[model samples]
Target: MKLREWVEAGDDARLLVIIEAQDVLSVELLRRQLRDMGEVSCSEQQAGTWQLGLLAHSCGSLDVCLARVQGKVAALNRGRAAAPAELVETRLVSAAAASLACAPMIIGPFTLVSQDELECGPRQIRFDGGKAFGSGSHPSTRLAVTLLERTAAELVPARVLDIGCGSGVLSLISARLGARHTVGVDICPDSLAVARRNVERNNLSSRITIT
Candidate 1:
């Protein structure tokens, strides 16, 4: 959700920089420029022939913010624009960041946990934010982590199994829970690479094996 989400559960000072276009990459660049203005979170979905979205930010004023966003959109339209339908139009909204709902998450020591906004046990978990699939988010991985934590004493299976392991992080979690033997497998080489990095970062070489 970041700072780019607005009009849901956020504050009243933020603005939305909405861009619509047929070119996805061009729209993405516009989104990046919006970030330069302030904190931004965006969502995109294909609506018939056009791409629809909402870019969230906290620009100072409506006019000034619109000017900034429009100028950036013009810059993005220069050379890389493709097809006649790919141009984008921008709009500004003075919405608050509190209006949008963002799943609150925290990572610490070596784990990531998500909780309700009202519940604030830990503040932030600084991670490398790598390409790994598990940055301590996702339901299935969280479920598996809970399983690992609860059954640490009863489970005797040396080799663990994680189906649909993104970034091979489930194995890293299993190893963290004291699994003596661990191996992670995945179809995505990038995800595997991410899993491997997580394992090495934790220094669980003797316990965790990732591929």
Candidate 2:
């Protein structure tokens, strides 16, 4: 699940630690070490580089965990003298929804509506912003939705696959637009968790699946 969800669901305080790794190997090593202390989540930032996020319920154990990570990093950078990894505490901010253009987006016959916005018609898509990316505000996602709108007629009763489906927005939209089945796939477990919630929120769980 998203860190924000976990933080809000539990009564205990949660800590989020973010770190930048020099390479994929470093990220893997850091994840393995941190997993012993708490839940570890990693995402690739660029070629050969990655970002690691560690979440824990106990604040008292954070100091010891940080110290152990520092010791490990120091040992790894002993002789070669590469730049040490950067680590910091981070806060989770809730994402807000907004219209893509000047007005509510009109994709084919369906209108995309933000959670805060009132339902416009029967063909409305209710989407809310979440910790996972792709809230339907990004230009790339808008473009994809537009393409799907234009070609929706040709895709009736089709089965769709959405790769790297962050929030499962496209998959939900595809199903609403008449696709018989939609499957959303992502490498991040947190993303899939959010996507599953989103699918259920839209009442399209019968046609959408997140993996």
Candidate 3:
């Protein structure tokens, strides 16, 4: 299903299911299992909780979708699930944009800009706020970016490796900061896809590799 369509569905749209778990592993597993049923996105929440959001089409009823998701969550967590899947409000895109806007994080020379904002200057990274993580909003990602910037001069003309790369932000930034080549590795195929798109968005395909 097209996520844009779901986001724009308005009042006629079926409610989207948001499943919460305490750990990233459960979130990842739920994402893998429920992806085929709809569009799934996972993110880390406060208090060590992780959320898996599934945006399903209005073609089916909300109850049916919730039941299916609950069953999947049960299978993954074996009755230890943190919480049941709930129906979230509409305007999914707006909600996502707001979440990103809540924290305008600056990482080194790059500043993460929201969709509504324009890139007023150079060294700005724009994220569409897609399913993959790493919009530079998280503390860990910001820290990594800061560390990379501090050592960017030393990393010039060198090959850099990024493990668990999300949204390929680090790899892209590394390439921008003078790394001759960057290799981003992630276990999630969905994350790799998002990273590849981000790499292409910044027009650094040749300098960065996402796998």
Candidate 4:
């Protein structure tokens, strides 16, 4: 929906970056580069594939950015022992299509749902990004949540302090798991805003503090 709004507001199109690779280090680097480019969201297509959605203001600019990224990926692959298949693929898709492709992600006992999927149960985490990062799709996010669940289970009534909390997923999770108080701090204003909205959406504003 945000992508649709961007296109409607005069952006050229939304470019979908499809990547199939088993290398975690390479994917993390590429994700960082894409994030630097502009608005980007990552979703795992399957076991070893990742879909990165980016808003393109101009086709020419998109092409140049892709070329630069491909060059960097190629350089990184040169050092690897075995290269993955079809490391990079591109497609221009409408916002509706992108939305469907980037569907809800189930992380541990929690499910990350968007605005459209509001009929979720108590374990659902509703997160709509306003140019903020972390949607419970990345491997790191999933792992972090898994670890949090393990630790939080043992530590009852714990207080959580999340530094650089993007989207406030961890803080929300801590509160949901019965933490006494949760504090999420972030340098990015967009992240703080999104985190606060998430806290309110989950009705954990009393227990979770976003700043």
Best by lDDT: 4
Give model 1's TM-score versus the native structure. 0.42
lDDT tens per residue, model 4, 1-211: 2445545634545666655556545555555565655444455566766655544334556567667656766776775786642435565656556555444556678777765564758888776655566666666877888888888766466788888888888888788777889899999998998899888887788999898
Which regions in candidate 1 have their CA more than 4 angstroms from the true location? 1-129
lDDT of 1 by residue, 85-198 (tens): 232444333443333422223322233321112332232222222344554434455567677777876545667876656655566656656677887777888777766665
Preferred candidate (TM-score higher): 1 or 4: 4
Q: Write the per-residue lDDT of candidate 3 for residues 46-138, one digit (tens) a residue.
A: 766656666664446555666787778667766664654433333333344333323343556766554345443577765443566665545
Candidate order by decreasing lDDT? 4, 3, 2, 1
lDDT score for residue 116 of model 3: 46
* TM-score for candidate 4, residues paired by index: 0.66
Q: Could you report the Cα RMSD, in angstroms, for every candidate shown?
A: 11.1, 10.7, 6.8, 5.5
Residue 62's lDDT in candidate 4: 57
Candidate 3's TM-score: 0.54
TM-score against native, each model: 0.42, 0.47, 0.54, 0.66
**Per-residue accuracy of model 2 over 1-211 as CA lDDT, tens digit each:** 3455546645354556677866555655565556555545555456555576655435455456556766766666667555567674443322221122113444446665655445445687765434566645344777898899888986686899999998787888898788988999999887798789778768888899899
CA displacement after TM-score superposition, residue 134 of candidate 3 (Å): 9.9
In candidate 4, the residue pairs with backbone N, CA or C atoms under 3 Å apart (3 or more residues apart, or in different chains) clash, namely: none
In model 1, the Cα lDDT at residue 92 comes to 36
